[model samples]
Structure formats: C-alpha cells, structure tokens
Target: MNSHLPTEKQQKLKQLIVIFCILLITLLFAFTLLIAEPTQELSSFELDQQGQKVGSGPTEFRIHNQQLYVAVPSNGHYVIPEADLKTIRMLSDDIATRQIAVDQKHVYCGNMILKNLNPQTVRSIGDGYISDGQVSYYCSQITERNTELNVVQEVWQILLHHTGIGSKPQSYWYPHYQLETSQSPYQLTVQGTVSNGEYTYFRGKLVEQANGHTMRYLPSYSGSSDRLRESSHYTADGTHVYYKNQRVPVQDHPQLMVFDFGGGIESEFLHDRKTQNFYYQTSPFSQKYSPYHLLNKDDEHAHDPLFLSQQGIYFYHRQEQKLQRTGDNPFSQKLTQLAPDVFHNGQDTYYLGLYDKYIRSGRGTKLCYRSTVLYRLKNAPVNRWQKIAEVKYGNSRWRAATIWKNGAQYYYFDEFGQGQGFDQAVYLIKDAYALRFILNPSRSSDDIRQYAGRGILLSPQVERLAKAKYDENFCVSELWSQNE
Candidate 1:
C-alpha cells in the first residue's frame, strides 16, 4: 500500500536529471581534447643532470660542462646537434629583438658570444668588423686598433650612398669587391681589408712596413690592367712593394715589374728597372738566389753568359733555378768561335745554343712558348749528333732566336742542361752544315755541305715539338727523339 507508482510530475523531474548528467560528461571529453599537448616523434635522447634535453633545437639551447650545443629541429620530429660557440655566459630572462641575448658578463647571439669582449661598449662599426671602445673584431678575431683607424665613418657613408638605408654592411664586404683572400683563421671578406691613415690590414692581419695612407694595389705583372684583380698578387705602401704579403727587397715601387710568362716560360720574372736586376718570381729562384744578371739579351746568342759570382763561375739552365760551379774559368783571350755557335779553347771544344718548347696550361697540356738554353762539349761521337728539331717559320724564329741543328744531347748535364764537363752534345743538330761534317762521319759530308750551300728552311713547329718531350721530373727534353 505504501509503495505506489510515481506521479507525472515526479517522473518528469527524474528524466531532467538524467539529461543534465549526460551533457556534463560530453563537455568534459571535448575539453580534454582541446587542451591536449602535441607529441613529436623524437629519437631516443638523454637528459642532462639539470633535466634539460642534451641535443640542439632551434627553440631550445643547452650548455653542460664546458661544451655548448645547439639543436636544430628537423621536420618537427627530431633535432640535429651542432655547435660553433665561442664564449659562454649564463643567459638572461629575455631575448633581445635582434635575437641577441645578454647576461651580466657577456652578450650572445644564439649559442655564441665574442671572446674576451666587453658587452657594455659593443657596437656595430661599418665594414665586416665589430668593435668595442678599444679594439676591433673581424670575423671574431681581434685586430689591433689604431687611433687613426677610421673604418666606421667611411662604411657608414658607403652604406648611405651605395646600399641605401636599413641595409647591413657585412652583406657588402665580398660581393661588391670580389675579394679572394688567402687562407686565414679570421674569415676576411673585404678586398685589401680596411685601412687607416697610419696602418693597413689584410685578411685581418696587419701589413708590416705598410703605409696605409698611401697604400694601393699594384697592376698585374702579366699585363692585366685591373689593379683590383684578386690574382694581381702585388701591393705597395708608398715605399715598398709587397707580393702576397711578403716584401720585395727592391724599394722602387714604380719601377718594379712582375711578369707572369704563362706556360713554363721563364718561370715568371720580376725586373727592377732601378737596379737593372732580374729575379725569378716563382719559388726556388725567389726563395734561394739573389737577383741575377742576364747577359746577352739576344736569345739567338748560344752561350749562356757565365753566371759569374764572387764565389766562382756557375752553370744554370734556362728554366731552372739551380746553379753549379765550373771550378775553372773556360774563357781566355785565345778562345775562338770555330763555327756559327761552335767554340774552340785550343784544348777543348764547346757548343752553345738555344731551343724552343711549349709551355703547359693549368691542365698540364702544352699551350704557350718558352726558349731554353743549350750548352754542351762536343769532342767525341760527332756522328751521334742529330737534327731532331728546328725553328723554320714565323716571327718565332727571330722573336725567340731559337735555331736548331744537331750536337750532343742534354744527357751529360741534368734535365735542365746544368752540370760540369759537357762532353757529348745530346739532341742538337749542327747549325752550319759546313762545320757539322768536320766532326760527324756518318752523314755524307759532300751532300750536307751542298745543302748548306743552298741554305736550310726551318719551321716553327719543328722547334716546338722537336725538343718537347716531358720527362718524369717535368723537364722538357732539349731535342726531339724518336720516342717523342
């Protein structure tokens, strides 16, 4: 009797309660999804003692122990670790708008800070340099600052004049000048670097003995007009000329000549008009010997002028830097020219001459021309003397003065025809047939003399390829052989 069916009002209230509970549960599920954290599929990594991630991330940085690391996030999944940090400092609360952060002791850009730099006075001076009140930094290395150091004003003007406002100076260092600096720890970009009235610098290092006020780029010795040419390799500071930073002893800057005879020609030379001295610009010659005197400017002259030093008489090759002493002087008042280039010293006979060959390209292929000197002793085996090559045609004959015939080969001397006691001529032809038959028995003397009477015709290619065999030592032979 007490338990009876509920009335209509009670039943409605129960239905309402059930509906409210369902709505609350649905809202709770939606809220959980909205606040869910984004999970990235990262490679397995360890945490440092401070509970910070060990690797580098674009958004996150970590420094543990002495080594610092940067994390670059990859495709939103993992991070690659790399570091080019210079100095370390405890970071501050907020990153500056330039992404540069500052702590009490230092200023930092990402993971790096300048070494031993005071952050209070750090300011951007123009050029590819940063500066404090005292010293300047180029590529992060300290270059001594002089009182006359005035890079800031000029750079600012250049920025306003050339690059317009709001542009950075570092962007213009390399492209505007196309500087090709030598290998240096500081990554120098500016051509010839920045100079003050009293000091000059290159590749972030000071140029010794350089007068920055009058410093200028020298023209190319190879006849290039471009003074700003990166390969010109010469600069002068009013009083002296510097080649690739090394000072040339000769102080006549205006009279200094640096010539690059392309190919194997002459190993490039530096001529000093003031002293009338010629120097080899390349190594070995420049490194070892003093400027030498070249006698007989005539290329046709057969005898290499005696390289007479106070020490003794020396023998040197046309294309080599080495010199050898003959111990005894061969020249005497009685010395006689028996033939066109043949000499007789009463007891000994001498043959002296010149030959032509092609200079090689950077690819190791023949591309240019050079004249080589030929010297030898021709007392025995005259029959073996052969005319392997000759200069028959073109202005090269007179311009180079390279005539060819037969004599002893270059074997007695070194590859460069340098040594003592030239006994047998190697690969030279007798220039004058009348004198040739006097010693050579194999050839029909009558026929050679007859041919000589008619006069000989020689071609340029004949001299070029005749003595042009490249040896293992990179020396070209003085005469053409059948193997060539």
Candidate 2:
C-alpha cells in the first residue's frame, strides 16, 4: 500500500485472503456441530437431574445410579438418579406380596387336597386358601393287650373322627391289614386279618397265599419271546400287538398287550411249547401316519395314511387300497397333513420336523427323496426354518430326534438308530450344527464338514434352553416317549 504495489492488486490479494479465511471458519463450525450431535436420544420417561443424557430410549430400572439414570416403565417412575442414587430396591415388600398373590390366583394348583385325612403323611400340600372357621381333626384309639407268652401284643383300634360343620369328611383307609410273620428258614408268611367290626372277607383261613416254590419264586418272564413269535416286529406303541402278520388278542395278558394306535385290531399267535398265546395289535389306519413309523409298509409306499400321534394307528381301506382320514374314530382327525414331531423349548418356540423334497442323482438319473426337515416355530407366522440334517441313505432311516431339556443339551436317537450307537455317542443331535461332524467319524473332515453334522450337542445356548425346560426336574422316560 505504501508504493510497494498497485492499489487494485493489493486490494484483490487482501480480498482473496479474507474469502479463504471465512470459508475455513465456516467448515470448522460445521464439523464442530456434527461432532457435538448425540448418537442416541435420551429416553422419554427417564432424565438426569443435571440435564445430561443418561441412557438411550426409555431407561429401565437399574442397580447403578452414579453414571446412568434408570426409569421403570411399568409405573413411569424413575428408579435411579444420575448421581447420588443408592441401591435400586426394585421390589418392595408390598410389591412382592402382590406378585405372589397374583401368581397364586392365576396359576394351576396341582393335586391339591382340600380335606386331607392325615396331614402327617402328606408330603406336599398345594397352595390354596382355607377359611378361618374350617378345621380338620383326626383321632385314633389304640388298645393295649398282653399274650400268655408275655409277648406284649398291642391292638391298634384307630377311630378317625372329623368335625367340619357343613362339610363331608374325606378319608382313605387301609381296610384289610396284614401282618408279616416268619414261617420258616426258607419262607415267610403274611397273615391277613380283618377289623373286629368288619365282616370276614377271606375265602379260606390261608386265602391267596403263595408258597416259595422254585417255579413260583422264579422271576416272571416278560413274554418278549412270545411277543416275537406272534409278530417279528411291533409298532412304536405297545398297544398294537401282532403275530406273524395277523392281529392278536391281549385281554388276558394285558402286560404283553400294548396300546396300539387306540385299540384298532388285535391278533393272536399260539406257542407250541408254553401254549402261551402271543398277541399283537395293529395300529388303526389313519390319514396321518406315525412319523416314528415312516418306514412301515404303508409309509414306505407313501400312502399318506393318517395315524394317531400318540397311538400310532393307521387308517386305510382294504378294498379301495386307498388311505382315508376320519374323525369318527377317537384316535385321529381328518387332516391333509399331520404335524411333524414336535419338541417344545418351554417358551413360545417349538422344534418340529418339516417335510422337504431332495433330489438324488444315481447313474445320471435323478430321484427325489421326500424326507423331513427341521424347523423352529416362533410366535410369528414367519417361523424360522433350521435345516438340521437329512437321511441320505439306509432303508427305513432316522425319523426325528428327541430333545432333552435339562441343565445341558441331550438328544435321543431316532427310531432307526435306536439300540444301535454307543450310549454317549449315540446322541442324535446337538445345538451346534458343527458338532455333528466331529462326533461322526465316518463323515469327511473339512470346514464344510461342520455343516454336515447332525444331532444335538452341548452348548451354552442349549444349556440355557434346557434349564428353562427343566427348572424343577426333567424325565428321561418322557423324552423317550416321543419315539414311542
């Protein structure tokens, strides 16, 4: 400006510098604003006393209040403060009592005895309310007597008396009492006696006595061989007994008789040696065939006959050779398709087998194998479908595996693999799909091999599911019943 340069050039340079500075300041301010903006908003119901964000969305009641504020959604109340908040104390005494009362009112009370004859012997009493005026009273009288041999024989004369002003007394008494006596070195006799006031019920002095004979003392035979003679094979349910492809009668031998799909047909076979009749009951022909018995003649033929889920009875017409579905029988209902083997997770989800079609290529020709697939049922319509495994080979192959919901994951082999694999290694499925390959040595080893595995295995998620199902106790028999 002082004769160093022209006025217009200096002015132009100054103007350019001013414009660049203004542009830089503007960009810096914009960047600062972007960084200052919060990623998530504070919950509507929760707030910090210092007007700072504590938690995202509506804050839930929390144990810590030094850094985060907690809001209880139920009553729209703040449970914790941002700072200076002590213990959460989620539930008060009154709240706990109210919750317990609600649960008692709505939940089912199993096997509850309103008027128990003897509370001393009652191991468990369900939750229920008793009126203040109601009272249960039991009294028994004992008479003492001495025998000539000076063996003090005390006569027990129990008299139970109850007083419930307007209620009937509920009593369960052992009317016929028997005393065990030593007969000899090889035998013991149970002497049966009736109460003094009661009428004599025995047919003879030594009525219904079993001597310790070699044959009588011998363990009772299960008649399994007899069962085999009647029918080489039996259905999953014991109900339908069969002998040599014919129906059998199970009236006299109920133990030998099994419940075939709901009393369809009974057949009998005679054994020459024992003259013991073997019986078999054929499952009723239904539109829905048993999934467990998918390898059966009708099932192999893809007849699509209906069968009872619990009973395993099939439904088919002999003349038409066509399968029929009818609700007339108590066992099954009319349906296009039956539900797959179902296993519950103790929540809204249920693991089920779904029918799927797979193509197998043999000698340049392709054949379709109509098999079952696994699916997870959720609360929504679009339930998750989890492809667990498939039966690639073998006739009358694996049906569906049974899941054990305990502290850890366990699965039972399908009907085909039953009594085949090692007890420990025989588990059908695992929660982790990868473990299936590790357990099955026959399968090839590769990264993709993990996907080829089948059956249940131990896993943290599976353990959680098991704990949920068996919060109290679980049963192995019930799990095996699924195969039956």
Candidate 3:
C-alpha cells in the first residue's frame, strides 16, 4: 500500500550504502595480498605436562622427521618405524637428565618411551652426552671421553669382577666382550690395554691387550706418605708413563733406571735416578736440567729450567706437545746464578727491567738503571723512563722520576738527593694518585690540590724514599740524600 510513499526513498539510499561497503572491503583484501609475507612451515610436536618435548633434538637422543619413528619401552628398547610422535614424552625435567634414559627396559626421554637399549641407569654429562650400564651415547652416536686417574682405577675393578683379562669368566647368560670409555664418554681405545673379567678396558674402553696382573695405580715414593697428588700423577708399567691412563711416550729411557718423583720449582717434577732429563707434569725437559746440588752445572737454569742452547739462554716450555725456546730475554752470555733467579756477569747484576719477578735486589729499578719496572724483568726500554726532578749537591747529585715497587706498595723518590729536601715534596699514597707524577713533573716538589691524590704527605714522602732507598732512574749517588 505504501510502495509509492516517501519510505521508498530511504530504501534506495540503503541499497547504495551496502554496495559502497562491498567495494571498500574488496580493495582492502587486494591491498593485503600485495604486502603479505611468505611464512615457513611451523615445527610441531607434543610436550609433556612439564612442558618438555618427548622427541626434539639430539638432546632427546631422538631425531624428528616426516616419518613418525617412535621410541617404545620394554625390558629391552625397540624403535617403532610408524607410530604417533605426539604420544611420546621425555622422562626427567632437569636439563642435565634430558638425554634418553631407561629403567631396566622402560626407556624414556621427557614423557616419551624410547626404543629400549636395555639401559641399567642413564646419566648425563652435559653437552648432549649420555652413558648407560652397557654403552655411552653422544650426539645420538657412540662416543667416549678421556677418563680420569681415579675413575680409571674404579672402572677397572668393575671389569675385573665381570670378565677375565685374556678370557671370559664362566657366566650363566653371556660372555662379556665390552669396551671401556674415557671421560669424554666417546673416545674408546684399547691401546696399552688392560683387561678385567668382562673386557680389556684401558679405563672405560675395552682393549685387545694390556697388563692384566699388575696394579693400575702409581707406586708411592719410597719415603712419601700419600700415593700421589691429583694434578701430578704418574705411573709406569714397562713401556710408557701413564697419566690417568693416557700414554706419554719416553725416548732414551733405560729399563733398569728407577723412576723417582721430585718437587718442581713451580710444580711436581719427575726425575730418573740414571738421567737428568726431568719431566714437569707430562712434559720432558732437556738433559741439561741439572741436579739440585750440581754447582758446576751452571749451564742449566734451576728456575723455569733455562739452559744454554746455541749460545742463547733458552727456556724450556712444552707447548702443543713439543719443547721450544720461550723466555722473555734469554741471556746472550754465560752467566752464573748468584741468587735464586738473579744471574751475575762478573760483578754486574743483570738488569731485567720489569719482566724480572724479583725486584728486591734493586738492580733494575733501585736506581740501578733509570726506570721503574713492571711485568717480568726486561732491559729498560728507551722513553719508558723520564726525568721528573734533578738536584745536585757538592760531589753528589740525584734525579727522581716514576715509581717502582718498594714491597707490596709502589713509591717514587730521588736517586741522588733526599725527597724531603725539595721545597714542597708531595707524597702520594694510592696508585691512582702517583699516576699524576708520571703524567706531570713539577720541578719544585709542590702539591696542586686538584692533582694531589688522596693520602698526600710532603714530609713522609721524602723520608720513606730515603729510608727505603727507592731510586731515581739516573743519579750519581747510590745512598739516600743526607739532607733529610
């Protein structure tokens, strides 16, 4: 009835609005396609209640692929070629125990049951490594690490009870032919081997042949109380020096000579009764390594074990499994050790600038030359030493610059004159304060408060240097200034 009324006008407007909205939606959809980014396929897997994936990376000892291979548990392990991956879960939550584990045959990783390997007890050794009662696993592959001295001894005992060294002991179920592994849990070797009832294990690995009857530990020094120090362990059977069961080959070693361990200048040393070629840790030094009481053997250095080779004082260092020259400054001429590390040429004390660890002699920095030293004693380099003050009195003159170690602390003073004699001598207490004396030199010992560091005292500064005889780089006088 109202078809021809004004309501028809409203209907016409509504139709136009709907058509305009459809066009706007179409434009936005096309614009979105133009700027859309490409997306990569997402990695998907089921996780346990603890939020750990049952099989993900090598950490789980399970590889993920398009084919769903599942690990199933039993008295022994089984790898199912076709199974739902979402049903599996890792066993433990601790990241350390994230590797595949089995309880008798209930193989587990997070919440997933693994293909059973008849695991007794699985232990993780960090970095995706796992070891079970039967074998060790690494990166989902068989591997071994080096064994420690103590662990080698312990593992050998387990082998001895299970199998005979040359032959398997009478057993009910199976004859043991197992191999041992090292600490790496991956490197298994049978070299220089030893055996137990189960397998011929070096430490944790099974070897083809080794001395089965002899004990694996080092014999105590005839006079010592303990067996041996942990870091410095050495044992020998007939052919090699074994440090934690790792072979250290020796050349020119006599069969009849007895091996005796001695104190190294820095660490424990190895000595043979018949020869002077001593070993520090696993390293062997030259034959020139003289005896402790050999006074005539001045050719060898006792400290750091330096020796004369090709007319140069070469230090013996075993780096990368080889001995080579490695001294900051090997002396050019033949010198005698008058003190511990202090060498003497005629009456002169060889100056080893700051590189020389020994500075108590005052040779390099005790006004001996003209420079305060740091690091190991070395010859004072040019420009390293600068003159900061100068004073001349009668036949004696003194100069002061820089600071050198007095004892535990460092101080600056004059070599010729007393520091107290200066118009306004400034003594700095802390290392940060004395740094200014090196950067800036004042002719008249006066303190600028801005530059004067904490613990500044003028009078005691001079007296301390004079009494302690802290030297200047270049001074005509050896004694402290009398003006104090």
Candidate 4:
C-alpha cells in the first residue's frame, strides 16, 4: 500500500507542473498581442446621396441628430447628406475639402475649397459675417452657397462702431428681426461705415487719408436721416475731415460750423467764425457780409444774415458774389427770412419766391423728407402775395399761398408744411418716390388750377422721368438734399 501511495503522489506533481507551464505560455501570448496592436472602437458613417461613402479612407464621422458630419483629410472633397443616401452634392473635384461647419441652413466648404479661403481658420464674427482672418464674407441672412457677399480684404481685425446710446447701436447689416436675439445681441449699424486700425471704409469704399483709429461720427442736431445713400454724415480723423466720405477743407476745425435750415436741408451751409468766411457746398463764397446795427442789439433776429437796416435789406445766397440789395426796406421792423423766401413781419408772414424742384432718383423714403428749393426775388410787392390754404394741427397753424406773381400768371405754393416753425418748400405727408412733375404757367390748365387749389399738381412727366435712364450721379451733389 505504501509503494502505491508514493507512485500516485509523483504523478500528481508531474500533472501540476504541466498545468503551470500551460498557464504561463497563455499569459505570454496575450501580452505579445496587446503590445503589437492596440484595440480602439472606430466610428463609421452611412453612404451619401450617391450611395457612396464620402471622405477619404479611414475617416471618422461625427453624428449629430442623425446627420453625418465628417472631417476629412485635405485630399477628400465630397459633401454627404445623411437624410437621403442618394442625394450627394459634389464640390469641385480639384478642391481639397478639409472641414465641415454646420449651421441651421448651411454646411460650409472649408475656406480653401471656395473663393480661395483657408478652411482651418474660418470663423463667424457676428451678424451673418464670417471671416478667415483676412477676407470677409457678409451673408444677408442664411449662410448658404451663392449667398455670401465678399466685402474687403486684409482684415486681420474688425472694429464695429455703435452709433446708439445703450450697449451699442443696432446693426443695420443684419436683418432687423435678428438684432436683439441671443445669437446677435450687439447694436451695430454698419451702414457701409466700418474701420480697421489703418483705414476707414464707407459703403466698402475707403476714405483716403482718414485715420481709422481716430475716425468718429460727426453727429448733427437731428441724428441720421433715413436716406442711406445721401444722409448728412460727417467724420474726422487726426487732421483730415470728411462729410459723407467727401473731403472738407477748413482752416480750423473749431471754427467750422454747419448751418442747416432744417427740413432735410442739412450741412448745406458752413460758416467759419474765425475768418468770417461762408461756404456753400464746401465752396467759399466770393464775398463776406457783416451784420447790420439795430436799435436792439440783444434781439436774436438782429444777428441773422438777412437783417433790416437804414440801407435796405441785404440778402446772402450761394448764387451771388456779394450780399445782394433788395431795394428799400418796405417793412418798418427788422425782417427775418424765416423759411428761405418766406419772411415774417411780426403780425403777418409773407413769401416772395420761385419754384425749383429737383429729385434725387432713389432717395425719398420713410423718415426722409422731399427735396425742393425756393428762391426769393429782389424787388417784390407784398400785396400780390395771397393765401391758398391754412393747415392747422396740434396747436400749430400754417398758411400756404402763392407768395409771388409775374403778371396774369399766379405762382402758388406747392409744398408748405412743418419744419422748425414751418418749411415753405417741403410737405411732411407727401411721398414722391423720386418722380418729377412740372406746372406750365403759360397754359391755364388743370395743373395750374390744382396748383392754385390744393397746392398739389401731378403731371405725366412723372412717369416719363421715372422711365428715363439716368446714371448714378444724375442729380447727385453735396447740395443734393436742398429742402429749403
């Protein structure tokens, strides 16, 4: 029995040794497999609309809301749609599509793939504006293909100037509805006025010699007019001065003052207090006129350019070289040319003027008044001036009439309405959509009768002028908005 027990124990030991060797061999093989190749779970994308998998080989796809978004190598150039496997859109074959940027309405083709932009660094600034650091892309609303507006170049940095009071003014660049949303909370109205550190741009055209660092808006008494193209805006840098991007020359910046007669007539006349020089449309008048001495020097009306004196009435206008004389002063008191050709005589007001209506093709819209000029005559009788109608509203009363006459022909007031007190030229309620009309005084017709009755007349000439093809500069000038 002892011999049998020893033999069994030896067999058991041999069996244990064999089992240990097998286990060691298995562990060694597993360690070798782990070191040779690492295990990672790779993502896979579905087929595109064309039934072909997009992007180059070994590409990893990103799935967002069941949509397949993939970042491909520089050599891959296809955009895939996950909703429908057969709706693939192919970019230019030569383009190396790099990245995919997904917005609600657009999936961007990395920068270099379209319009020579760099995809690696493309980013959105604000208000549908995107940039690759150098070039700008201005999208009106959605940022889809064929909807981008390439603005300027060499834009490493963008500076938005807010003309509004609170945080900033609302941006006119984007749609009005998106202005206050969380996505776009900045109040910034570019209005074709933007600046970098080196240059200032208006409507994408650079203002030459204007320092962008110092460029700021020159605010008028009535803010900005609704006319985007022809508003009376000014900006100045360290040494240069610009009025709506046009250079304005003045000896001293402090001495230059803008004298506007209200009613859309803004920055038309500039006066230099240091030199006593008057500028019309930024051009110096040939002569200067000094104020006349009055019994009451303290009276504000006595300091006007046109004041009554013992030597008759002296008038100043852009058409004359000197202060033109208006014969003898008929009125006993000092006369103030309240509204261009309209004058007040303390008790009754009189207008002795002529009509010269001009239109700027595409500029009369909401918040912007009409454009017209009224020229006052030298020697005219006050008795011929007659009233046509009276407009009364909100504790205000205004009289409209034919303030001048040539003979049997009576020239009546056309547009007579609100201004500081009242503008004898522009009617606040009338919208003329850039049309022209003429009244023939020689022929006593319906036009003249309408002119005499309601001070409003329409002619077929309006349609003709509207159809007439005029250049962008047809009636464009610094004096373009002459609503006297």
Tens-digit lDDT string for candidate 1 (142-169): 2222234257654444334342332222
Best to worst by lDDT, what's the order? 1, 4, 3, 2
The TM-scores, one per candidate, come to: 0.31, 0.18, 0.31, 0.34
Per-residue error (Å), model 2, residue 470:
29
Worst 10 residues of 4 by lDDT: 460-469
Candidate 4 segments whose C-alpha is farther than 4 A from its true place:
1-115, 118-130, 136-192, 221-231, 259-335, 338-341, 344-391, 394-415, 418-484
The segments of candidate 3 whose C-alpha lies over 4 angstroms from its true place after superposition are 1-100, 103-117, 120-228, 232-240, 249-274, 279-312, 315-320, 325-484
Compared with the true structure, what per-residue lDDT tens digits does model 2 show for residues 17-136?
Answer: 999997886576556545553223245434544344322222222323354333322222222222232321211132111111111112101111223222222111111111112221
lDDT of each: 0.39, 0.26, 0.35, 0.37
Tell me the TM-score of model 2: 0.18
Name the runs in model 1 displaced over 4 angstroms: 1-193, 217-233, 246-248, 259-270, 278-291, 295-374, 377-484
lDDT of 4 by residue, 4-25 (tens): 9989999999999999997786
What's the number of clashes in each of the models?
18, 41, 54, 14
Worst 10 residues of 2 by lDDT: 462-471
Q: Which ten residues in a row have the lowest lDDT in candidate 1?
A: 459-468
Which whole-number lDDT from 0 to 100 does residue 248 have in model 3?
A: 51
